[model samples]
Target: MSPAAAPRVSVRLPGHRQMALGLARQRLAIGILVFIAFTGLLGFRLIELSLFDGPVQRARPAVANPNIRAEIVDRNGVTLASSFEAYALAARPRDIMGNKEALIAALIRILPERPPEAIRSAIYHDGKFRYITRRILPEQAEAIRRLGEPGLTLEREAERLYPHVGLAAHLVGYTGIDGRGEGGIERAFEQRLTDPAQLEKPLALALDVRVQQALESELKAQMDLQQASGAAGVVMDVHSGEVLALASLPAFDSNRPGGLVGMPSHMNRATLGVYELGSTFKAFTIAMAMDTGVLPRMDERFPTTPIAVGRQRISDSHPKGYPLTVPETLIYSSNVATAKMAERMGRQRQEAFLRQLGMMDRAPGELLETGRPLTPAPNNWGLASVLTIGFGHGIAVTPLHLATAYSALVNGGIYRPATFLKVPEGAERPGRRVFQESTSHALNGMLRLAVLDGTGRQADADGYRVGGKTGTAEKVLEHGRGYDKRRNITTFAGAFPMDNPRYVVIAMVDDPTVGSRMAGSVAGPVFKKVVNRIAPVLGVAPDTSGASEPDIRMFEGLYKPRDPKRDPNAMRRAAAGLPPLEGGVR
Candidate 1:
């Protein structure tokens, strides 16, 4: 209230006004700072989105991964393929700072899949970018990200996933680190698989998962039981040429090719390894002869006595002195009769016939792998070659070739290429004629007779009307000359529901030891098991006679034996016209 105080107050601004001005200054300073920050951020964003567009990335541009779309399904619309999200850790080796040893130690400690040495080599590679590892675990990738290393980058990628694991390993095959097909259906149709449009659509295979599993299950069990070296099997629709089931032992895991022992495991023996597939080839020979009009009736007689050519002798595994009929020859697998039958067929007719059966060449199917047929040329194929090859000697062929051939000979004489993909009706390629329908029918009867009365009884499945031949081929020696009799390839190539002949199943074991048992004892049981399971799936009615049933014929004899001169000169002349006799029958 004093005069001096009033004068001072008049000179000063109001407290409230002063306070308001101070508040404004504070807000203006904050606003300016905020504007500068926002401008800088907007400029940075503009440079990133515009200048670095496709190349610069927050998460590494997905690394050009196929960005796998959904998988393909079968005709039944079952999921055969799908994709899973994965992470790939990579680094610019030049930029990786900290001691190389330390980083590798850290990586090795965390990711043990790759050896420390391997990781070091990869990390130090001379490149702009190199993958440290792919399909990284989320937690692990997150841990790496938290390390905040500028040199290392974690990329988001989509990888092809086979949900069933090994369920369809051979059927679907698998992809490599890069999205490329490696084998089986995957490799066979790599181009189609990589096609984006095809990826959207489902890939249907002819395989029945159930049948495949069953076949594998039985085969694996038998293999272990017999302690066999390797096993292979196939179930094909005779009518459609669709492979319902095909499997090979020492089968590698598609998820990881290196998971197997070696390249040997990758080889598809069913389609690749050529062998002198013993008696099973007799079916084709007889069929060829019959079709050529050179084969006599099943009742026609052949020389049961041993036939000699040079120093080599053609003798039956189960020989008889009396002349054997055509059916008897097949039933007993008489080497003499079959060889004689080949002589009757002669070279021109035999070679022509075999070529007709797709025997003188290779057959490439839908597999990335292919099979090579080992047939002596007509010039090299002398009398001996004809006889030897006629009985499945002198030359070798893959089990698939024989299977396809047998399928043709029995399935109304139409040899359809076996397929893994589900083929639409009428889409199958028609094969060259190998035999007459009549020959096929007769073959069916003989095969039935074989199961009932011959070496192939083990192939019979009650109601399935199974017909086939059993072959025990000795393995070729490593050194060259003779066959290693101790190591044998036991095979049974047969068809079931013989009357209808819907599917053909082939079972083969490589170097199967004659343990305490023989081929018939070891491989035969496996054959029985496979047929029992697959028959019903094929809609083949059970033979009223269980699998143990045999066809016993009480029939009249076909020919009267000629009581002629036992001429040694005639036999010596026969011996002159035989194979090279160099390679032993395996």
Candidate 2:
């Protein structure tokens, strides 16, 4: 082993060769280290880019059509409102390549409705973007696109379409250009309508389009005939408080929201206008009296003579010239008798009854246009107030309030809050009991009798057994300083098929002319027309059979027919309290 070690160091080499070999070894070692370092740096840079680099540049989103909003339908699946795709004309001020004046003139030619000044302003504005016109027709959009203006653009948008024009305008409402609800049911259900999860489903309302048409037709005809300032009507299901038809005259087209500016055409008179609904209150008064046992029997007599209270005299519009039974008071619409009955009930009980019937508060429903009922202050609710309110003078309420109260009166004494939505089967809330079932039955009989033989004769629909009350209240003028002798608000509060009432129909005319001022002459006829047409549509079969035996037996001998042959002088003498006939008043 020692000998072999000594032999290895004997060789000599040139300086350049040795230096080259040394350099090569050193370079090889350095190259291997550099490779490892470069590999690690590249791996670190890749990880950094993957985890911590700013957001990577992404391609612009593709332009797509706007999504359509949901549709609105009536109870029978009739489409009321819907949406469709449309193009909006917009401009990019920076990208506009055409002459500004030329673009403005071209836009005016295609969309002539736009003012020339507005189009010019939009085209020359400093802003980056502006919409020249929204909801343009497809043809108009195509024409503008073909103009080849770099600045002009057609962006897809959703537009609301009202199929029925003015039908249910107040109920279905209208949406703005930005695809948001502006009023009525559309506004009430805005969240649900625009919800992404429910856009495909249509909203169903409780209104029956057929019934609505009938009601509007009759109300419009009567309004035209009477030359009224305005008219309103409603048809409601009593048990569920579902509003079948609600109409306000002077209706505006929902599709044309711009035309409604500075106009009262969109006022929902049925639920938003409060008026003194005259003798209709008599029915409520009599019902309250019966329910509370103040008037024990239908034959109980109340003197019809004018009652002087606090310098104000309450008298019947048509005097009976003698004491009238509880039933006869309503039949004759005697304000004096109704006042007497209401006075006996007193203000506390009277207010309680009204409050129970939802007359003292805003109408409960989905609509935001409900009016708060006007009532006297607690301190002002004196004896005179009670007497006046008995005939619907001191207290003012919307036609909707009257309709709901009438529903409670005949719908087995239940007072349910009115609803505009379709109530599923067995989904109705249990209503509060405002009167005894027996009281409702008795009132039904009296209402029928009034239509058959009393002042409500004009409201009688042949074979349909329509029953209701007529109201004619003088409008308060000069802000309640006094009443206007020339103006009156006439109303008819009615229910059909008197045996078992299913619907409550209310028709009212504001400030009808003198010739048609009476409710019996104006609103009564409207009610009859509406009921006659909607009865079969609502599935209410006509019962040609006369009043039931119990009804006849109870009402027999209660109403004394006017003797057409009686001496006119004798009748006059009796009215003056100077009696000549044996049956005359003392």
Candidate 3:
């Protein structure tokens, strides 16, 4: 109140001064609002960068997420296929700031795999951007970064790695440039591998790494020894239909799949390459006869003399001048007897039996590379077709098909589709019945006899009670010039511990040049070696006493003992520049 009284006599402030004061106040208020808005915008930008924008996104290139692809492992947790973070070298040609020559030199030094001229040409290409390389190592990226080239940018990317390399290449497959699976297991389970829910869970295959290694090594060794054009093999659990090992040659590396496009070596012969798997089918014919009661007695006899069907004359490779019993027919691998068995079954019944055994369709399994069986059309399937198919010549199928069929035949007549997944213990899959249990048992005994005294003598492992059949089919000449007498596709399909069948193995060699070229000579040894190597790893204890062997006394006097001097494998050993076998026919 005292101050108001003192100012009462004074005049009011000038209008310009009052206006200046109002303007100052307004300016102060506007400054605070501007400051607050700027602060909010800066905070929002920081949050967006921190949460959504990182090195991968800022690179502005398509990059695969390593975490998206689930690791692939064997049943024992041995890593087969995996994915990892890597770097790619990309360029913005228009944005070049450093010396072009220097940059090119640096790139050449960093990546010796890339051609020097390629780098130079890429830099000079008329384009806004280019990828110098993709899936480069971190060390390479760092080396290139030291060049300080403004045009060059290193991008984070996902690289699919096959730690085992070509070990299980065909089974694990490979991812494409975009990181999507393209073949094998990778393609078969693309959805599962890429699913977010399953990313953390590894895909465990039925394959045992040790078993697979042994199989591949032995198969490859045989292929090299025989100088064969190609080879295929399969090891499967007879009871559960689980494929423990599948191999094909010449094998390509999974890590370097880029060069494998359209190459025959890239083919998965185990599942994709079809061949006339010769005498392996004889087992099926004999089993069919037994199951249908067409041949009720094991001693039922048929002439081994060459038989004529239409215009085709079928003869055994090593002909016997006399008739052979049903069991002896399989033991000697006589085509004439097998043909007669099919003739008795009739074409209709033979076709029906094969259909039930899955010989009329593609092999059922987890592989997308499975080949459809090549069989005579129903309308064209005549008696001749039946006879030849019975001997395994008229029908073409993958090695996997024979393996699966053999598994069914030996696994107590149950037919289960082959699988690559690790089945839980004590939880076997349900299967359909393909043969009577008695029929299977009888066939097992006859096959054991074959290994003991006939064509598969070389296929026996010391303590495994190995039993198998050998097949030798002439390859049709290029351009359909009829079958070539010199070139053969030889195969051996068999099971071990025949008394309680556990595994089926199929091995095939195409056009072997260095051996006798017969299945017993070329392919039988592969089976023997594989069984001996993998049996111990698979927990199959050796039975040195033959206590667990199948009884073959049913054919006691039905056939003559095989002569050691006539062994087909003798010619193979001689041709390979090796000494003759000291223990012949073993």
Candidate 4:
């Protein structure tokens, strides 16, 4: 072999020190490279979190960490329910370097809405934290808890829990999956509900559970019996103007609202249903005439002669041709007489009366949705228009409008707006005056007569001395070009304890079919049924005078000379030629 190629092998080398030097150099280089790569990665992560985070992080501990559920309470300091800190499953796709598949399977058990495919993609995406399930039930949460730590994270967050699921469903609206109020008092008082500093206080509502239940029960029975489309009932304290019971059927269970039908159950029809209010406005008109010193006696007659408006006919449900007295006008609900009164009062006086009674405006309350009454301008008002309005026509008002007006008429002519929340002591908002004291007192007696002997007999309770008006206006249908009078709205607005009025009850049914009993038949009876249930709960004992009421008549046939020769058939023929019909009259 050549000398250059000869082996450099040394015998008995000391500790192989020269070989160790080469190996150490290689190891040092690897260590430097690893440290530099780690620093770059950490810097990138800091930038990503700081710059790209939105409400998620502020909501993160809320969305991730399970330590911040808020508490919910009722007015009486009852813990209807509360939430506790619980882990919500979320994932940072990039951070999940392990099995993306197995992690998703674990996640599926917690949130079914997100299928395995969705989870896999989420775990593989570049998001910081994608929510898997928030506000999970305790059982579901426990199941997720059993999943050992891997790609799964149990970050602390507040989970909403409703203790009494159906008790206050309407009052305490539920929160979104992320713990935010969506409706009812929860949404209304959201600032208060989610207020970090003021959660110690419970949300106080003016609802009495007992009264609400009673009202609901009666309304439900009627809804089913009548097989009606829908029903709403309200009981308001005439004196305090506090809403005792506001029940709208078809209510949804707020605790579980996933599959709920929107718009129907959630709608507060009592405050939202604006209708012509039929003859319910008659009481207000009569009161206005009485207060204005126009109708001096119940026996004073209005020329029961049918009058014709521009395109509408003024008549009564029950036709009378004689000069009917004021009491008879109300007892028989003479649309012609009412129209005459409206004409005498004129549009200016009518508007003034309505404004004074708070009917020309929206119903009073803290509800986000309050209905406004529709009163066309007076200049546009004509004789027929004024007459129709006096008898409660051409002008559409809400049930609340009727309620407020009735309350004023009974509460010594003081108009008070209705409220859903508790009003403080000495906080009685003495509303503007709509009726005079004597006028109200006299009307109360006349109203009692109507209940005892007139069209309002159905609303009379055995002892409550309930006096109210029945209104049934053909439902104004908007066809292709004009309104079709195919449907109708039937309503009854009444007050109890004729001697001392305390509460005003308003019951209304929309588009009630022409059954064996019509609006006066169906709606009036339904209203009486509601009164039956609510009167006791409201502590308004029966007067034991249901069988008897004060003696008062609408007219004495003394206001105007009665013409015996006035052929009723001629007036009918004249009214039949009642201005060419412009809108649907069916």
Candidate 5:
């Protein structure tokens, strides 16, 4: 056929057929445009997911970032626990483009702590993704990125950090592998700390770092000096019930809590370990006697003879053989006299007062590690229980329990629950009245007299008007055989600037093997040292002029100052350059 000249093949159609053919061509064009548009969209999405977002991020929705935690700070705004941005080494084995052996060696060099087998498995993982190591340092992340392997990647993550490692470990607590709080205030406030709406807000505790440091340092020093197995200390605001400092010996580092697993260091002795705090309870007994109107006068006398109730005989550690006045009974720490007072109040009145003081229940606070007090079962509480528990035996309560009770006894008799959260300045938490204001006033003088002429003399910091009670209770034998005489827990619970009590401080030492092993010599000195350091920090000014001394006129003629020469241990203590013990182990 000739090219264009001979070939003129054309066909004509009717109007309806022509219309149909044109419509078909238009529909075909539109379908091609739509397919092209859909193909472009799919390609763009693949690039966005693989290149921009990265595979690591694609899997992040399944895992929560541990660093999404709020900081924890002391009352003074000092950082205690915080979260910091860190990097994690991850891998996508299917996308590996480098020598697997070389990559494994490089990773092993970067993170020696990670097992070589783990690294190799992660690189050759038969899965979409795997995590090689988390919480990697920036330098290490940079090193890994320098390897330039397509499969290897660094993912953004977060890590918890405690700057002052063991400062308040038992109180601040540590996080677990899943970034959740496990103990102390951490577990107590886990919800608030991890809430997405409150992530940026810090958890401010009532602890003052200065006070905490001083308390922990002094307690540790005394624990070591006394050759004691353990120690615990607490400093709380008398009026506000805010715990300024709480220390438990053998503290573990919050940053690495696993190092001391199975050891007693992790136990918060101040809050979680309960003990029968001996003669310190005498203060409560005396107050109870006065509050219940059982004793009309502080000068009323109680015979110091041993009293027998059931099979148990109650005697004084330092018995003043002659008849002694009420003031004399406490000054002497006479168990017989204290038991006699308890006999007058009876068990019902005693239990009621203790319940009012929060002694019959678990110590109330923010911490989850709080100890449940071990008291005699209500059905089994008998005369023996009454007599012994009167002077802090039979019933076991935490040091925090005693601290909170002591605060009530001295702080105008208001029983406020102890708190770790910072109470705003000029604000006071409402409290229940446990003792009459007049009774509290009387206790202030009695406690002062105790420090001046009784078993707590070693605790008196000059000019600080420190007034507290000494407790030296024999520990109960394991399995409840009997109290061990050779082993005792020494404690001193008191408040400073007694004329107008501001803070209550308690120090306890477990099983001291050094010196006298008495509360006066062991725990008393601890209280004294802690007071000397914290009084000024807590805004309690020193007044050595006796101007701030409580009015102790009612107790003036009740007892006489011990003639140092008459003290049996005076000669030995002076020879050893130690303070004279007024009533050893009472």
Candidate 6:
């Protein structure tokens, strides 16, 4: 049959139908390509968001409030405390999807410090969210994120960082995980530190890091050598009341403050601990007497014979058998002589002098931890109180208070408030005159003599001409009910370059057991070391004019030789002109 017309069966064909079918096939192919492209783009976008997005994008709604604190720097612009962005691990207990026991066990492996029971309890708690750990490292955050638990989350937060670790820890305190300042200057200046408008500017402290290091090193060495429980030291600009360096040993690292909570190591001994600073107060007593004209002249003599007040007897630790001149009283650190002077000054005048020296109140400073001085009540200011306080036994004051007083003694009698903030050059601080310039000069000369020929002889730092008084006081026990004879607080408070005083340095050792346990043996060496190291850094030139010689000779023949073979009673016998007793004096 013919191909095109077999049995006359021909298919009908229309041009419009053929065109419509071709158009429909094309439209369907184009629709499928568009859908594939849209799906590919969506997948890429999701990958980018998961891998490249910042914590801000990935953080869950349970994040804590962000706290940004201002930076804290030393006088030289070295950063001490600063803030950085960190990731914290948080958990939404209700949202946990993994096996509870297994998840907690795994968490314990990562955070071994957390007990297994703690993890379990936290996960089982009814709270919506809670922090597992804060300030997690990036690797830790990554490990936590890969745990595949819906409850676990990484939250962006700000964390305070102390780059210097334990350096000046007592002064530049740490903050809580929530970024609130907890102590030290951190807490003292919290408002200014957190102010939004002031955040950009760093808080500059008067602390010279070099000086601080020197002070800490010496104090820590003495603490270790003497097996002391604690120690404190300070270096202050006498003229301006700027605290160049303040150190308290057994200090905790500001970075890990939680470890030190409730620990004795956390105490700011320089400011918070009030102590019965022994003979160091003798300088102040003499200065006060001289200033008030109770002692007419340095040549005026006070009986060195033991004085009886009730059952207590006031005697010099290392007494000169003869009477002591006003300057000789300080040079020999004669408690009996000083008590007689206080008796002459009387209670009212003595209290008024102490008040003038700022010893009757808490130390004026930015630190909220400034200790309230333990002064006697008005009614308790009897003759016995006066005698004991004259020799620094009844009254207690912080090392900071002593430092302020010493500054006034050397800085031409100006009593300025101690400050942690740097004082700009030419800045004028409001201060009150506590001593006459003549009185200050005379006291300085006598202090220089004490270091030159007396108990503070060990504290002389070559040409620095270190001048200070040694104090060894028995610690009070049972909340001031009695005294612990074995335990003592040894301190040496002084200033450098006797010719012209620039810095007031203090070193205190709490309960030293090694060697003699005298201020000269424990704290005086620390003062010398600190001054030796920081004097050069402070640009203080050594003056060897030997101007303290005359002052030193004024106390000639006043100090009796200590009999080492009979050390326990040497001081007493020397005072009494009796033969040495067993155990001699220290």
lDDT of 6 by residue, 447-547 (tens): 87787667888898876767899999999995868899999999999997766788999999999988788898888999999999999999987644433
Tens-digit per-residue lDDT, 490-521, candidate 1:
88888877656777888887775446334565
Score candidate 1 by TM-score against the native.
0.78
lDDT of the structure predicted as candidate 4? 0.67
Which RMSD values do the candidates have, in order? 12.4, 10.8, 8.7, 10.4, 7.1, 11.1
- Which segments of candidate 3 are over 4 A away from where they belong? 1-67, 562-586
Q: By lDDT, highest first, what's the ranking? A: 5, 3, 2, 6, 1, 4
Instruction: State the lDDT of candidate 5 residue by residue for 1-586, as single tens digits.
Output: 6676786778765697889989999999999999999999999999876764444333322324544788999999999999988887888888898789988998999898899999999998887678887788888889888888998878786678999999989899998755778888888988788877788889899999999999999888988887889999999999999999899988988988875666989889999999989999999998998999999987778888888887888888887688888877777798988888998999999999999999988987999998998988989898898889889999899999999999999999999999999999999799999899999988887787788888988888988888899999999999896899999999999997888899999999999998898999999988999999988887888865555567665554567767534232343345456675445321
Worst 10 residues of 2 by lDDT: 57-66
Candidate order by decreasing TM-score: 3, 5, 2, 6, 1, 4
Q: Scored by CA lDDT, what does every candidate get?
A: 0.71, 0.83, 0.84, 0.67, 0.86, 0.82
Off by over 4 Å in 1: 1-81, 93-129, 167-171, 259-262, 425-429, 514-518, 543-586
- Clashing residue pairs in candidate 3 (N, C-alpha, C atoms within 3 angstroms): none
TM-score of 5: 0.82
Which numbered prediction scores highest in lDDT against the true structure? 5
Q: Which stretches of candidate 6 lie over 4 Å from their true place?
A: 1-66, 100-121, 124-126, 259-261, 544-586
What TM-score do all the candidates reach, one by one? Answer: 0.78, 0.82, 0.85, 0.77, 0.82, 0.81
In terms of lDDT, model 5 sits at 0.86
Candidate 3, residue 506: CA error in Å?
0.5
